[model samples]
Target chain A: MNPLDKPYAQLALAVLAVLVLPLFLKSGILATEILIFAMVVAACNLLLGYTGLLSFGQGIFFGIGTYAAGICLTRWQIPVPVVLASAAVLGAATATLVGWLSIRRQGVYFVMLTLAFSQLFYFVAYTFSGVTGGDNGLLGVPRPSVGGTALNAPWSYYTYVAVCFVAVFAILVMVTQSTFGRTLLAIRENEGRAAAIGFPTKLFKLEAFAISGAVTAFGGALHAMLIGVAPLSNIEYHTSELILIMTIIGGSSSLFGSVLGAGFYLLLADALSTVWPRWLLLLGLVLVTVALFLQRGLWGLVERGYDLVFRRERAPETPAEEH
Target chain B: MTDIALQTRGLGVKYGNFHALAEVDLQIRRNSVHSIIGPNGACKTTLFHALTGRVRASSGRIELDGRDITDTSDDDRVRLGIARSFQVTSLFPNLALRENLRLAAQGRTPWQALAPWRRAEANAEALAIADEVIERLALAPVSNRLAGELSHGQQRRLEVGMAMAARPRVILLDEPTSGMGIDDIEAMKQLIRDLGRDHTVLFIEHNMGIVMNISDMVTVMRLGRKLVEGPPAQVRDDPEVQRAYLGNMITGDIA
Candidate 1:
């Protein structure tokens, strides 16, 4: 059996990545962002990879979390734990509503519904300047203090985000190993058969959405703290696209693939943006290459490497049967 | 009557102006192998769809153990003891054969199906049912293989096994032997014969030999209506059934 198939092995890799990022990168802030996005992207994978729902409304939950953190921290100075919890709850509530409405349709129509919801949310945040601070966003968000000392340094705050990242990653891993996760995969494979076998597939899909929304929101709140501001861009359509792109580039087959995708995209952007202003064009070329050659993303490459090194023989592919 | 495991009255399904099935009445007896047979486009599959709630009936009602379940959702119908396999094989192609069976076994308990904290392997009851199904279907050799990797015969048997995993009182199998060789057909025939001992098995088939050999009762259909229904020997001998369906096939097989 592949070592990566084990949950403990995957978790250990996550811990290793968290420990190693600081050693290679000079910017603690960028390292923290990779961890935050990793959690959010993995949440997206629960829908896209496991449940086969290509949701575009993940940014809605993520943005809601940012606003939750922004409003609570800037105005009320609520405890960090409470603020984080509220962000997750609000994200879940919003996701439930969106998932319920969007899942009423399937295929392209479902994708359209989520995209429309993303736009609607963006406008709501934009129009409600009184609460969301309109274009300026809600600024002056403070990082949580540990004991009596404030995590004023970027590296100190990276430690805080790293702990949350591990917890969230483990929870997501647990969910995928559970019966619910297996059912989600079943639904992804054949929903009609699942329903015939007596599984309420729609409810399961909605529950996946809820979990994805909660995790994405938690990541959003962390991002707000990482930057010390909840920007309006956090809720935009572009944010949804970026998260989806990372999910695709990393591969959806495994949870760790999500981390690889987030890290790869961010690190690539950081490197290219400094050297060339036309970095997006280069990114487009990368996307095409991934789509054409690396369909399973970076994780597929890693799996191929592992197979070559250890097994020296290709795993047998399941022969397709004609209908 | 309690002897009737499943019953449908005045069942009809319409798509726009076309009537796929009309005025179809069926009474499937308890613990009998009931087979529905017809020529192509005879609405045989349409009847199974209406019975299993895959397609809405424009008129009339369906009952399970004499209880009205005309408005029940498709998934709820499975919980209410009606499970069905598709005309086209529809197992979860990406999942292992064991996991596919386990999902079906776990379907009866929806609350536990949503247990996110507990591992899927922890559901001992479901695991046991899956293992029993694998053994019963003689799929133990390839239990760990992906469903998509199975041959047409194995997939067909797996299709029936998945429905059986639900432990449903009424099992509806659509074309359980649509595409099988001689040996596969023999195995499936014996499997269906055994299934009738415990389950009220309703199946659709084109294999006249297997149908006549195993079915306790048979319903012949033609162009969205029931042509005739009786014990296999009686149905085969009926002039209307011979003219509409059985024709030379029945005589060819018996002779």
Candidate 2:
């Protein structure tokens, strides 16, 4: 077995990334954004990688969390913990509704339903200009206070988000190792057989959606605080696409792959956008290359590197067995 | 509570004018090996589907231990102690053989199956059930291997083992030995005989030899209807059973 397939190894890699990012990058904001997105992409993996669901409506939950933080922090001055919890609750509720409706169909229809729901949510956020702050979004979203002082410095906020990131990552890892996670794999491998084995397959799928949405929204809340604005783009179709791209690019096979994916995209964007304004054209090329060669994404490359260094024979191909 | 472990009365399935199965009645006794044997297009599989609630019955009453369960969903049917294997080998291919059986064993308790906070391996009961099934199916040697990586014969055994893992009161095997060599067939026959000792075993088989030797009762289906059903000796001696297989090549095996 690959040593990296263990949950501890994955968690170790996550911690290493969090600790190592600040040393290499000058921008604390960029480092913090990567961590937030890493969590979001990992949540997406819970659906795509484990449960065999490709949800385009993830941004709906993320945006909901962003707005939850934006509205509560700006107007009501709710405690940070309460706001975060509310975001998760709202995200889970929305996901349950969407999952219940979408899972009635399978395959392409299911994918289409999620995509349509994404559009539906985007328009609702757009139409309710008062609550969503229209195009301007809710601005001046203050950072959480730590010991009677606001985390005004980017690095200080990074420290706060890092702690949350580790906690969330550890929880996600634990969840993926659980019986519920195993059943999601079973459902992904064969839904019909899973049902025959006596699982209420639809309910399980909905539960997965709920967990994914909750985690994604929590990340969304963190993202809002990092940027200091609940931007309209957070709930847009493009945000959904971006999260999915990171998930695929990192490889859906492992949770740490989500980190690699988010980090790779952000780092590449950071490096290239200054050199060329249309860096997205270059990103498109990279995506195509990933699709053609690295079907398992950057994590697959990492696994190959480990295999080569250790001189171990490559194990037989299996779906992601670890978080 | 009753001699009948599973029962169906006036069971019929239709696809807009074509009757896949029609007016079929079955009373599978408790702890007996009942084999359904028939030619292709005889709807042997359809009957299994109806009993297991995979396919909706057009007209019928399905009873489990004398309780009506006609409208029960497939998963609920399994929860009611009815488990079935497919005519085709169906398993969680990416999962280990142990995991495949564990999922089946865990299916009996869905609340535990959805407990995300705890490790799946911590469920000692499910693991024990999987290990027991692996031992029974003689798959212990490769229990850690992925289901997709196993040989065809091994996968077939795993298929049956998955159903047994559910610990169901009524177990349905749809063409359990569809493709098997002599030794594997003999092994499967023995396994089914042993299974019948404790669980009600309903199987659809093309192998007449296994049916004749192992089955307590034989049910012959022809063109979506029951032609004959009785003890193996009685079924083999029936003229109607002989006539139904007269033009078919399987008639030679029946003789």
Segments in model 2 whose C-alpha atoms lie over 4 Å from true places: A313-323, B246-255
Relative to the true interface, what fraction of contacts does candidate 1 keep? 0.84
TM-score of model 2 relative to the true fold? 0.97
Candidate 2 lDDT over A131-209, as tens digits, reads: 9997999999999998999998999999999999999999899989999999999999999999999999999999999
lDDT against the true structure, per candidate, is: 0.92, 0.91
* lDDT tens readout by residue for model 1, B145-225: 889988889999999999999999999989998888888888898899999999999999888888888888999888998
Instruction: Give the TM-score of chain A in candidate 1.
Output: 0.97
Summarize candidate 2's per-residue lDDT along B76-167 as a digit string, tens digits.
Answer: 98889999889899999999999999999999988777878978888899999999998988888788888998888899999999999999
Residues A27-145 of candidate 1 have per-residue lDDT tens digits of: 99999999999999999999999999999998999999999999999999999999999999999999999999999999999999999999999999999999999999999999999
For each candidate, what's the DockQ?
Answer: 0.64, 0.62
Candidate 1: segments with Cα more than 4 A from true spot:
A313-323, B252-255
Which pairs clash inside model 2? A255-A323
* Residue A116, model 2: Cα distance from true site in angstroms: 0.8
